[model samples]
Target: MNRSNGGAPHRSITAGTDFLHLAIEEAPGGGKSDWLASRIRLALADGRLPMGSRLPATRVLAGELGVSRGVVTEAYQRLIEDGHLAGRGRNGTIVVGAPAAAPKSPARTAPPLPRSVFAAAPGTDVFDTMRTARARIDLSPGLPDLAAFPRAAWLRTERHVLDHLAASDLGYGDPRGTPALRRAIANWIARNRGIRADPDEVLIVAGTAQTLTLLGRVLRDDGITAVAVEDPGSLGARQHLHNCRLATPPVAVDSEGIRVDELRATGEAAVLLTPAHQFPTGVVLRGSRRSELTRWAREGGGLIIEDDYDAEHRYDRTPVPALRSVLTENVAYAGSVSKLLAPALRIGWVLAPPRYRDALVDAKRFTDLGNAALPQLVLAHFMESGAMERQLRHLRRHHRHRRDAMIKAIGTHLPSAIVHGAAAGLHLTITFDAEFADTELAAMALARDVKVHPLSWHSQRAHRPGLVLGYAASTPSDIGEGVETLGEVLRRGGAGPGFVR
Candidate 1:
């Protein structure tokens, strides 16, 4: 049997297992570490060890290779200091970059979530990638105070639910939702949103994304061809509607809310509105406009799909009642705990008009049978036990503090920018008097590890350039620093229609 100088089987030592199958030969004049590092670098360059691949622990790899752990550690440290790898706490060492002079990726495309899938050009798909991109500070709008999620309350309620649950409860549930959650949500809307409905009338769907898809199907089956949306509306929502094959004609939004007259001119039978707090602009539907919208819906047999996003996250204003509360005949009201609690819980309810109620339920029943039963029951417990109310109170105080910080930062750093939608919701939009492409501003900010949404991304028509900055998810320090960095990038004259590719 052949044995190495270390008195081990040569086959097991040289061809033995190691991360990336890197083997060490009998130590040459340069030593085992040098041999190991060379093989690793070669593997990285030749694609045997791909990016994001995690290296084995030093002790484990050393044992397998019949070498001292110091050899493995030395090899890893050399690669790390060279910027080819990084040691993430609790995640072990991962390959972060390839060896220098290795082939680079093809020129990167624009950031994600633009209008079309047209090109490597900025569109919805690319915009989505941007959302997932790592950043040191996140100021993307539509996020709540996620750090304040009631983990203890949720656990207590979930434990109680599991203790009392029947084995059958673990099986497939009602497609509409669990009875307990529907009843709890009904009570929630009655008290908070001012909408009264039987638990049966409340159809629990996924988040608003699925809500739009379901409504699109139901409306099309009802011979409705078009749905009017606010011009500076939600790009994500628009993409959803378009995916469902519905025509989304644009209606202008003003200081008060969506222009009701322009909506009527669109001749669409349905309209999606974020009446409580308009997206991007943060404008609430004023009383006069609310009446006009209701009148338009009632007269033309049009449907009002009220997306009550960020409705409960109010500051510097009284509550705005849900449109479905006043005009239940035409408004299909939807509300989710996404902003109030956390979006990971894809639980929301829809109180649709009587005409579409049964059909919508049928569509839901065919979709996924229903959301999981355990989470729904746990949510019901949270609602009935008043934990959600306590959470809301705590979030209000914390978010208010962060919002103040964001406003101050904007005043200090982006003084020339006009802020919009600051009174309510997690985000505020700022438009500039100086000419520059908002997307380029957003891209530069992102390069500095600050995330934001360009105003043009949300608008359907030509509009002034602006940036939508979210404040609730970040600490006050992060928010201020992020905005300051944005100002620095703007001062560097990097604002334009093109991005840093």
Candidate 2:
């Protein structure tokens, strides 16, 4: 019998096991089982061996460590008794328990956002801060009914895609986008937005925000300095352009959409417009204004960036054709599922003029190497299968009930406030005739746990004080409570003497 091996190895200076680099040398002469149990406990505490991870067999590990079988068996038995592992007979040992994670240090925790965020002039991070701020009732615009996201449909589509996905398809995809999604988008836009485009011409992007950033870079390279934006337009969009060092000269927007004459007067070669349903105001661009805008683009060599957001959520009005449908040569059309499905998807498409198409693709290549391939494929299938159409129809019916609820609440509680853009879209804009700071009202309402966007935040020039309130995500009961709370806040703060009826 090899009596020396029963105690310890004399010839080897360093005996070790390959699994988790377990070193037998680190154990005391008679404490091998204790050291092994300690190392395993540490591994479990630090998450190296998570629950359900299969461990090496006692015999195999004993051979690897040049230890007797009984030594390894004793060590595993200790962990099994401690409930950190379980013996599964032929399945070997499996990790069954782990220590609770240590609490984070106070220094590592982020401080709560300050209320002054609403008081200060809107900055690039203003929206980011407001989103993180605590609130019980959020009426922030530009959000759809997120609770209604089609999780079942998405999961089913995702499973089908993964089941049929090729190994090669997992590699880097086309910078332009997957051809399946491009073709699907072409068909989708033609049917819904009235924009007929070749699948080859479509460029997939992260969202409308990325669309602005990429276009800003490309337009700068092409020697364009400034892009006019509608006054009281999307402040977030304006901020993206400003971050790219492009000046956003303000052009007034009225009931008929952006003032093309004011846009031309700015002397900027390019303009960004949300014509289908203008932000905050929610007015459609009249046909005559569309003609003037087209003439500006064709005759004056202007570029139009059409943001067709939320056009699919109409309640009362007929569908408006996308601007890209009319002016193919100079219009750069952008649309996203942010308003249709959820903003978390970050999927949008861009159709640029022939001159900017190639440059835009190159910009996309360097920006993030194109959007993820699988989601594009999944969305493509969802659209082609008529699931997207079904989703739209469902959202239309669901949102209409909530919209009507909000309208009724406003009429009952805030009758003095005049509402705009209620015929279609996810939100309504209400303006007060009397003078008061809308931001102050918003801050006070937020203090009562109600969140809203001050209308002045979107405007570069003077405008009537208002609030943009979204109803799509809230239940009818909550909508009623929130509007009633706003009325209570208004009465307590004595907003503008009294809101004009």
Candidate 3:
């Protein structure tokens, strides 16, 4: 009698398949199919073979395991009968179901975030927390029409860059940024904002946030202890400066933008400003005030950190030249695509005065080895190819319509509310004569699943009760509905006395 006919393996021999490492020697005498089925079930229970995973062909697995085809076929049939898998003709077997998963331990789960995030003074992580909070409508400021991101144009430019990329381009890039993107940024600001700069003057950063961070460090190192910020300025920017251990002495902002007089009164060596389009307030720096600010920077020896954010998103006015254009020696200008494009790109540029230029570059060199080279190259191509200009024109048209719809809705619903910053930027600030806290209104609105920032969150001084509502990211219908909901919330006395909805 031949042992081959009986299919009994010798004690010295063993057979195994790569599919789950199935071993014929591990099967009981004359129970190969049973053992194989048990192994698959174990794999399913432990999540090794997840749902929708395709199994190897029975014939191929059988050959690998040195088993007869019938054994593999029978094993597959067992799993099929158990509803763990299904077979498609010529498509091989696939996992169609998995065993119920074991329950996770209570200790392994994260605790829910507190709902009091909007109740008190917002911490540094407040924005991070709010972003993750659940809500039906997000009217958060500092966001553009994210849905309008030019994916096709970006992809086309990305592909073009990749096709023509040099092998050396993949290595470590310039800590300051790629020359292509720097040149593109230089030309971009020149044409759009009237700022003259060489590509070498541009230092690509993560975003305006990083610009503040790096500047804060460099300023502090240079014996600067304070940077005066607009009273109703960006709380996030103020927080960034504060985190860098710099005191943010608040300077009042009136209709003429930041008060140059009060900024000088602060006696700080440097000041941060949103001059072209002031954050939250949306007031443009007037000509006289601009001149005064220039005099302060040039004559008073005060450094100006100009955040030229959202200068290109104007609707009802001609563009204002960036402060860097006239006070190039005293001003450090920063801009980013966060307001123009989406913030997710994490791309921005800083043009510091020659005094601080080397320090900023050194700070960037040690921080993340510069932004990823591919995106820098792609964005450079996008801007150089005139695609960014076209995108800006398209965003202006789209944002204008949304801004109009929001103004209309505010008028129809909250007639008593005073809307500010409507002339430009992605958001509008509406103030109320009510005595209630804006944080209370924000919390109430959040309770109704509408997200917004309390005006007080952006103001460090005593300011009017208001809310900052963004229109650029939402549809007309959503904006209308969100404003209507806010109206309803106010009518319910959420805004306290003197508020008329």
TM-score of 3: 0.75
Instruction: Give the Å shift of residue 392 in candidate 2.
Output: 0.4
What is the lDDT for 436 in model 3?
Answer: 71
Off by over 4 Å in 3: 1-117, 124-132, 494-501
Cα lDDT, all candidates: 0.80, 0.83, 0.83
Q: Residues 244-346, candidate 3: write the lDDT tens digits.
A: 9999999999998888888888889899999988988999999999989888888878899999878999999888999999998999999998877789999
Across 53-156, the per-residue lDDT of candidate 1 in tens digits comes to 76777878888888889988998887764446666545566676665333356433444334221122334556667656666678888877655677767888
The pairs that clash in candidate 3 are none
Per-candidate TM vs. native?
Answer: 0.75, 0.75, 0.75
Q: What TM-score does model 2 achieve against the real structure?
A: 0.75
lDDT of 1: 0.80
lDDT of 3 at 252: 93
Candidate 3 local lDDT, residue 89:
54
lDDT measured at residue 338 in model 1 versus the true structure, 0 to 100: 88
